[model samples]
Target: MCGIVAATAQRDVAPLLIAGLKALEYRGYDSAGLAVLDGGQIRRVRAKGKVREMEALYRADPFPGGTGIAHTRWATHGVPNEANAHPHVAGRVAIVHNGIIENYADLRARLQAGGRAFTSETDTEVIAALVDERLAAGLDLREAVLAVVRELEGAYAIAVIDRNAPGRVVGARRGAPLLVGLGIGENFLGSDAQALVQVTHRVIYLAEDDVVEITRESVRIHTLDGTPVERPVHESELSADAVERGEYRHYMQKEIFEQPRAVADTLEARLGPHGVLPNIFGAGGDELLAKVRGLHIVACGTSYHAGLVAKYWIEEYAHLPVGVEVASEYRYRDAVVPPDTLFVAISQSGETADTLAAMRESKRRGYLGTLAICNVPESSVVREADLRLMTRAGPEIGVASTKAFTTQLAALALLALQLAHQRGLDADRYAGLCAQLAHLPRAIEDALALEPAIVALAERFIPRQHALFLGRGVQYPVALEGALKLKEISYIHAEAYPAGELKHGPLALVDESMPVVAVAPGGPLLEKLKSNLQEVRARGGELIVFAEGEAGMDGNPARGALLRVASGGDFIAPAVFTVPLQLLAYHVAVLRGTDVDQPRNLAKSVTVE
Candidate 1:
């Protein structure tokens, strides 16, 4: 996980590069640096901490240049220090890189043997040395870059600049994402289109192993092996306002409240007059759903929880066998991919490293088709899939996902309805589910309105050290998600279990210091969940329940502790139930004085394995 921004423009581009790096800072902010080519030399400034530190250093003594490259690094090769930050320089070549170079040791040894010295403990410096050696050995800047790229042994998206070539910037991508931003009398490069959206909406997403060379006036693309290629410049639909916090205290809170709109946006096109059609997932989605023999849902983190929820919906409604797996474990294992199985990848940022890798593995193992339910239209996962469903959650900047997760559930619900329609489901049942889907936005709004109560619920947990969450059947994943949210933000040790499993093991951990939160959706399992809550009460544990209003525990003494969450329908109740849990975690984190947006040791996107 890292970020890169480069530009060659008609005027001083250092400010532009700084702004782009600041925008991409969510990707990673461990260390930041910039290299700008001025009158016949490359000047670089690197710092060990947040982007603001680099910004301060630059402001103290500015380095302005017409062409430059900047990076915010999530450290992989060495400790995050000035020496280990990006913008590593050798000879006249300066480079900023995102991915690991597997054979960096060998290349470093070769370069060192050739009398090339390295100043930083990074794989990027090795590339710089190799390119510098090539340039020294009678090759032009672009020629040296292409030559060195041919010998690279691992995934990397890099931007290189040569002092001799003052007006040019060379960029290459193999695995990590890279894109070019188009503008009049200027051109730009970034790890994602979001960084450049403020500068230009027109972008060309570079394919795997594509090398691009950009100048002040023109842009050219070539294959890694020197073959010229043409790539379409698509207009990015995300606006600068989407990434802003507006009046919200934090991006996470803004995203959490945006659930109502996010779910509505996701369901906007899917709910048509003829009930749920399959074309929402691009062309041939209906055909794929009809022919699918089984389904494998793959994702990581919050996306994995969404897939787990989908497993319940797909199997119950579509009546097909569905297996959900964490993308990290799924990619490494020799998973059984049944013939004609539709491999589904769910990710908020389609560039999630593990999820994308799992999707590629599914393709390699001959899955019938690959489907990606992702928010970003030009994400690597969407591009790799044969069928794609774009979740209209737009740009989710928070490290802890909120809107993205809810919108994914909406998309998955539509997919399940389409599959059920193909499997000859009863018309009344189909129409009911469609209406439930339509009601989700309003239900989520009602849940958001209950925030003041959830805030009070959160206050009770401020002194608690650990917690347990319980639910049965379809709501079990909701419990898991609740536990995940609590742990992610508030730094509380929380665990979730099926209500029945509390007696088997988890009950032992319940005590006065440990709180128990239950997701009690009014379902067939309601009585069983009530019994489980009684067990927690008997164990002298404080209980917090996110329950449906008509669950009929009306006169119970736990009413003070129980907060009612809205239900769109039994099918879409999970999305509504998610709101209170998210708010609880957010408010608790605020009270605990922890960083809600940038939690420690976590980056927004896991772009590296």
Candidate 2:
């Protein structure tokens, strides 16, 4: 993923563009650059590193202009370096792009055959050069952009500016996020709302195949064929303070403690008296629920683990046969998704490349209907899905994801109950689960208070290079998510295995140096989980056992630390058990002095496949 920001203003736009880029840097920070029109020519400056490096470069030799485009790149086709940075220029035209061009090789060959020279090793530069070549053949800027788009393939959100057009900029998107911010005497364009939050909260989300022409005074929208179209501008609910870290030491920790509030917010509009679930999907949900032959849950990373947990809830409560697949691998497998099958795509950021692609594939094959459980409103997944369930986790900044994952589980559990209700499952059973769901936020609050013990354990084990996470039943996915958070931020080699699977092969890796974090809540799987923990202890692996209430094992206080989470029923236990693991990972990463917000080799959003 990469970040792009463009502005056309009556006054100097460099500072505004830079500030916007800084806000969007969480998307990508491999290299940053800006291109501005100066004295009838495109002037550019770029650097490979953090945004601060580029800011220093700009201050040293500024690009003077009232209109410009900027980018923070996460390199895809080229290595991260100054030369590979964005704002790739050709003649007097400059371009900054996010998303991949699948047919760049063929397009580049054609351009090279036409004697067009390239300055950088980027697919984006190809777009710039193609536009320049088209303009050289007497086509205007808009026509050239249209022609180049016709020749290009794959996903892209591109913003281009030409010195010839002066204070004008053009942008288009296909499979990536792009928004137009409306302001007085100026208009802005960026990959997301974060970039424009400082300027305005009024935004128009650009749809696929839509092109926008932005001028200093106004923004005009049109289809690829130059047909005028009306796009609705909505006021963003995002507050400037929402993006701040507040009193927390890091965004990760803030997000960890935000779980209780996030879960409560997600349940706000979906629940009523007596724990009744709202009909979010409308009457169509009834038809889809009735015709469903099977349920397929598709997602990636932490969302995938959430889906694994949903599979348990859906099958157990709704009595539906369920299949959980990683979104990236799901589309390629030979598994049959019949016409009556219901495909549920779970993604915190609805723009996740693999999950969106999987949704498209499911629709192409005529699945009954596709549903999206997403955090961001107006995201591509939410727009394309036949149904939507929005999570109110509000802007999870940490790359490892804390609040979003828990909120997704909360929403999905509600969905599972709603489906069970529609399926005519026993009313008392569904109501009991709903009552448990209502207490989850408070359970999470009690769970979060165990941070001191988790932090102490983290201090003891942060230097360790490897760890193992174990759980049984629904808690297994919590184990996976915990291991994922540790590995993602701490750069530790962590593995999550089902407690039953430990003796199969993972037992060989156990030792004194390896920490075994087991989810041993008092549930149906407690005895099996204890057996697994005993196996690890017998192998001399350090134990970090998370259980409910006071249940201490004998004579192993030093070698092992036990966290007694506030007791909850089995239905809500996963939500409670998740908090301490999140804390442990956050503390470990902090103790190791890792970049928790923008982890190495990762971006907040995965906009590319």
Would you estimate the TM-scores of all the predictions? Answer: 0.96, 0.97
Candidate 1, residues 532-553: lDDT per residue as tens digits?
A: 8888878788778778753434
RMSD to true structure for each model, in Å: 1.8, 1.6
Clashes of each: 0, 0
**How well is each residue in 1-609 modelled by candidate 2, as lDDT tens digits?**
789999998888889889888878778889999998887988888999878899899899876788899999988989999989988988868999999999998888988997887777788889999888888889877778888888778899999998899889999888898989999989999998888888899999999888898987888888888888989999999888888889998888999888999999999867775665556755476567667767899999899989999999989988888999998898797678765789899988788899999999887776889989999888999989988888899988777889998899898888888878878878788778888898889989988888877877899777799999999999999999999989998999999999999999999999989899988788777877777888988878888888873334664466787777775789888778888888988889989999988888888778999
Q: How many backbone clashes does candidate 1 have?
A: 0
Give every collision pair in model 1.
none
The prediction achieving the highest TM-score against the true structure is 2
lDDT of each: 0.88, 0.87
lDDT of 2 at 276: 50
